[model samples]
Target: MEKNKTIKRAFIASLPVLAGYMVLGIGFGIMMRDKGFGVLWTAAMSLSIFSGTLQYVGVGLLAAPATMIQTAITSLIVNARYMFYSISMVKKYKGTGKYKPFLIFGLTDETYTILSGETPKDANENKYRFLVTTFNHIYWIIGGITGNLLGQIIPFSTRGIDFSMTAIFIASFTEEWIKKNNRKGAIIGVVTTLVCLLLFGEKWFLIPSMLIMTLLLSIKPKREAAK
Candidate 1:
């Protein structure tokens, strides 16, 4: 009974994320299909390169056929920040036993947000968290596979699907902004991103923008604390 309840709660908590993943995953699938990858390729990509934005970019990489060294460098550049996110969770997820692999595998932006914000009062918090993470991952897999299959027959434009990722980022930023009492961090984030984008342009701006944003926001809290 206790385990069943935990599963129920996890399913409910993950419902919203599941919806988002389905929509975005479908977009990615359509893009991959248009690029000439079949179902096997799509499944492999989704399973191995689970990063949505990176996976989308990877479609182009597949078409262009980068060397192993280039693929490694590109993946590292795009996903370097995941190292930082993992650092923050070291203590929260310590001693997770078999759950460790899944935790690492499912540590996407949405999963992290949901797990980090979950203040579980129940005794099975770890189990519940794991369930939530696994559920979201399954949603992504399903969505990706469905989209790839559908893309074979459907005649739809994938032109604007790329924008869906940007929309997700905006929505996430807005939610974080609204929840925080301090507006200074939010303002700094916006300013830094804009400056970096102007300097670097859309082609090569993300890493630098994130680094500047992190540095700027890192000091704001200390300043607030010192006051």
Candidate 2:
């Protein structure tokens, strides 16, 4: 009974993510179709790459056919912040067995936010977390495949659909900002990103911005402690 209840709650919590992934995934699929990839290619990429922003970027990479080194560098730069996320989860996922790999694989920003905020009241905490993460991943995969299939049949323009990923990022940031009581951290993030965007432009600013923001935010707690 408790297990079922946990699953139910996890499912409900995942609804907003489901809606977002579907729209973004559909947009990606439309792009893939437009780029001449068939359903199999779309499904394979969706299943394998699985990182939402990276998957969209991967489409361009695939078209251009980057060397493995370049691909690795690109992936590392984009996903380096995930290392910090994994650090926080070290304790939460400590005792997970074979499940550890799957848990790590599915630890997106949204999954981490949802799971980290929830205190597990049930004995099957790992199961609950796993289900939630897996459920969200399946939502993206299903959405991507469905979108690719739809792209073959639908004839409308997909020009601005790529912006869906940007919308998702904004929504995620808004949610995080609302839940956080620490004004210092939020201010630092905004200021650092703005400055970096101006100095480095969109293409090269992300890593530096994130690094500086992390450094600044790390100091906030220490300063507050000293106060």
Candidate 3:
């Protein structure tokens, strides 16, 4: 009975992810097809990499003659945010046993926000997290394959499709703002991101923003405590 309840809660939590992933995953699929890749390739990437923007960038890389070092640098630059995310999640996922590996692998932006906003209270905490992680992964895979299939038959413009990922992040931030404490942290992230964009432009802003935010937060404790 309790397990059933946890499943229901997890399903509810994953619905938004389902919506976001379906749209963005479809966009990725369409983009991949434009590069002459097909459904199986999309499935493989989605299953193995499971990164949204990185996968998109990686498609271009794959088409080119980029070396291993080049690929590594690009992935590191693109996924710098996860460095901060891993710091906090390390404690929470400490006792997760076998689920730890999968949980860490599947920790996307949306999942991180949801998990960060709240820990399990009444239910089995690890189990709840496992369900949430597993469900979201399944949703992503479904969306990727669905898009791959649809992109084959549909001719469409991918303009503004990338916005779906941004929208999902915004929605997650909003949820954190409304329900979670530490609004200052969220404000700092926004301010740093905007400043980075203005200074660096869109193509070069992400890494700078993440770096500054992590640095600011790292120094926050002693300084704030001194106050």
Residue-by-residue lDDT tens digits, candidate 3, 25-93: 877777777787888998898888878879889888877858999999999888877877888888888
Colliding pairs, model 1: none
Q: Which stretches of candidate 3 lie over 4 Å from their true place?
A: 152-168, 223-227
TM-scores for every candidate against the unseen true structure:
0.79, 0.80, 0.87
Q: What RMSD does model 3 have?
A: 2.8
lDDT of 2 by residue, 28-55 (tens): 8878887888778988877776787788
Q: How many residue pairs clash in each candidate?
A: 0, 0, 0
For model 1, give the 10-residue run with minimal summed lDDT.
157-166
Q: How many backbone clashes can be found in candidate 2?
A: 0
Name the candidate that leads on TM-score.
3
How large is the C-alpha RMSD of every model relative to the true structure?
Answer: 3.5, 3.4, 2.8
